[model samples]
Target: MRLKNCLFIGCLSLMSLPALAETVNNLFQVREPVSGQTPDEKTRATQAALETLVTRLTGDAKAAQGATLAEVRKDPQQIISQYGYDAGPPESLQVDFDPASTERALRQAGLALWGSNRPVIMAWWLNDATDGANLVGDGQSSAEPLRRAAQHRGLPLRLPLADLGEQSIGNAKTLDGTDVAPLKQASERYGPDAILAVHAQENGSQWQGKWHLWLGDKMEQGSASGASAAELADAVLLSVSQRLAPRFVVKPGASSSMALEVQGMTLERYAQLVRLLEPFGGRLRSVNGDRVVFDVSGSVDQLRSQLSLARLQEVPAGEVGAAPVDAGQTPAVEAKPGSTNVSLPAGTADQTLHLRW
Candidate 1:
């Protein structure tokens, strides 16, 4: 089989946080084919798009049936910011909603908001062909269906390069094996936030597959069957979203205030940090040098979990609240003999955190 390292240009551009953020900001957008730009057609399309956007943002397919959805339908224009037509033989209409208004509706509805800054999953897909089994790589035709499913679910998926270096780590044997260490090693180059291993086979008109996903130190595996490749891909996306929803979903409730010390604080870094935290309903209560206190709607544990997923490194407990340092400066301190610095446990209250960017 021919293995290539090329990735989709569009996919590669999403690697940066800024780019990812921009994409997430537009998560509420939807495009649908239309026969003509008639008033009735536009209205119907807008409503459909709004429903899709609500479901996509909440990760709950039934979110559209809720009270907030009713409010949106009552005055759809309240949430819709702009929309236009795309040139096509079968004309298509694109709708864009106001993010702030949509989010407020979600919060008022007491539903969780699955923000767009999601974890990037590196997927290793293997398919059984007539001649033999083939590994799916970047831009492979066979993988297009899976990519569309990922887009539908708003999940970002990257395929392996399957280069000589990757093959040396493991091949189909290691991928199909019970051990996942080799696959993890092979995935390091992509800097994935998580790893997914999927093996699919076609039986007549139906498709079946088993998949394994590793997020941080946790691992989950499942099997699915579908009537079509698209159906199978949607099933896979649903399973993956189930695993991710708990960690990323923002449920509504009373707000909580937490104190945190952030090392390496600068004017620019502080602004960036606020933007990152704003999605979680974080508001700055106070900022004294590197230490910050935030009034956030979510619990401290939830906040920590989200930050970790965002790639922020947790400063060792001893380092928390250590005097603020200027940009590009490191703190110099000698550890005491026979004294060990213990890192705070997960869910610890008011622990200090640091951003790696």
Candidate 2:
């Protein structure tokens, strides 16, 4: 009887397990540069901020222009929790959207949403300037623009220390090559879920970058140009956000019911798993010893991605096989006296997935 039923309170509609990925905060807050403090300027910038927020939450570049969100675009102020201007070298207006209101509005519009529980990215950026080439370290002046852009794009970006050893590893060949072994080896200390390498150079007044990203077995490459380093960083990070969204985003009308059974379940792990599966609508079925069963709704891929964040490994077929459990139906687990195994009904393996942490 090591398992216990747990209560779960849903937070933002995002999926990142506590131990596996970093939980990003202030996702609903957005800041956009403004020309002046006039009412008209504020309105315009606020509207722009709303568009940026929508793009960040949805991970679609053109989502701001979708017809479904026309009403939200018309009255963006309804979701604003608070807004004000920041005084600085380049002034900006900051808007904080109400989480509950924003989530409701987006769901009502039938739009797919990406959660704030996202993977942390390690950025290995090399800036080739007229003076000399340098690596953007975590504590260097060159890192500010990248940090700002990462925050704006809702990416959890990390920078390397750029010591002599790391600088030797950050050469042009390592940054631009198809082989990621060298960069991956260098990023071992950073503990990021993904790695991004950028080879940027100053061409007269404009900055151009050729960037490559590696996550798991997949890789993405693109190029961007901007008038300044900040703009270039923003463009590159925006592209990264767009590329990463589809793998984790859950669409409104694209879900199916499935049964999930996890071994090594405890009360604490049960609570954590519940939060991780919030977006999938996980409902508990039964708890026996260190095992627990849950009925959840979502694609198998989505559920697999969510569970992986908690370091859960899927058991191979025919190894602790599962029987399908319908919606609102309890899984049939037969417990016999003095037996450690709970038997599952036969011939329903395809509809259920078995995993262990």
lDDT of 1 by residue, 136-192 (tens): 777678677777667757788888766666645435566556678888878877877
Worst 10 residues of 2 by lDDT: 5-14
lDDT on C-alpha atoms for all candidate structures: 0.63, 0.79
lDDT of 2 by residue, 87-190 (tens): 85469999999999999998888887887767789999999989999999999999999988999999999999999999999988899887889889999888
* Cα shift from native, residue 229, model 2 (Å): 0.8
TM-score of 2: 0.85
Identify the leading candidate in terms of lDDT: 2
Error of 1 at 49 (Å): 4.1
User: Model 1, residue 163: displacement in angstroms?
Assistant: 2.5
